[model samples]
Target: MTGSRSSSRRALLGAGAVLIPVAAVAVPVVQRAAERSAFLALCAAWHEAKDTHEQFYADNVRTFEDEQRVAGEIDRLDNVALRLEREIAGAPARTCAEMHAKAKVAERMGERASEDIAHSLVADILREGPGA
Candidate 1:
């Protein structure tokens, strides 16, 4: 019985070792994909709502419509579901730089968007701090 138990324990340990590498690789890949998806969605939303956002946040303040759009934006950010403390411990500097650049472009074009949009995006990305 002792021999069988010890053998079983060894087998489980061996399996865990193999699975660890697989899981490590897989987790980052999954996280990177999810992060990309979230980023793309925000870009798309900005593209579609740029004008409306400018009018809403910077000037006219369209109350009802802007509320809906803002809610959607917040919800999209939530969907990224980034594990910030874990993710930031990994390296994401490159991706953060890229995101910052994109935000700059969007800000400069805030005739199409308001400055607030760029600010919001940068703030959210930094807060998430997930790896590229």
Candidate 2:
């Protein structure tokens, strides 16, 4: 009877060892899925902003001052992109909600830049020619 009990214990331990690796694999899969979803959402928002900004510039409505302003804004946006990329690459990562919040902030910044450029262009057109 004692020998039978020892055999049963060993079987249970062996089963537990097998489960550890399965659990490990499952955990990373779940984490990767969440990260991919968050990344897709973020990319969607960024693309929308990019498309809108492109449309805004399609009017050929910029002035000399507007060009300078846009140049500065583009520099700033580039920096933001680099920083966000780094943050995304390094973990402990944030949830989808947190990523959306960050994306919203970026969207707002882009919107503000667009507005500023439009206003500058309109003002320049009203004030004088391209030389001014």
Best by TM-score: 1
Please give the CA lDDT of all the candidate structures.
0.55, 0.55
Candidate 2's TM-score reads 0.34
Off by more than 4 A, model 2: 1-22, 55-61, 78-132
**Predicted candidate 2 versus true structure: per-residue lDDT over 1-132, tens digit per residue:** 999999999999999999999999999999888876766555555555555556555543378776565776655556554454444333222444544444444455564434433343345344444465
Worst 10 residues of 2 by lDDT: 85-94
Winning candidate number (lDDT): 2
Residues 17-51, model 1: lDDT tens digits: 99999999999999888876665555545444544
Each candidate structure's TM-score, on Cα atoms with residue i matched to residue i, is 0.39, 0.34
User: What ranges in model 1 sit over 4 Å off?
Assistant: 51-132
In candidate 2, how many Å is residue 58 off? 6.8
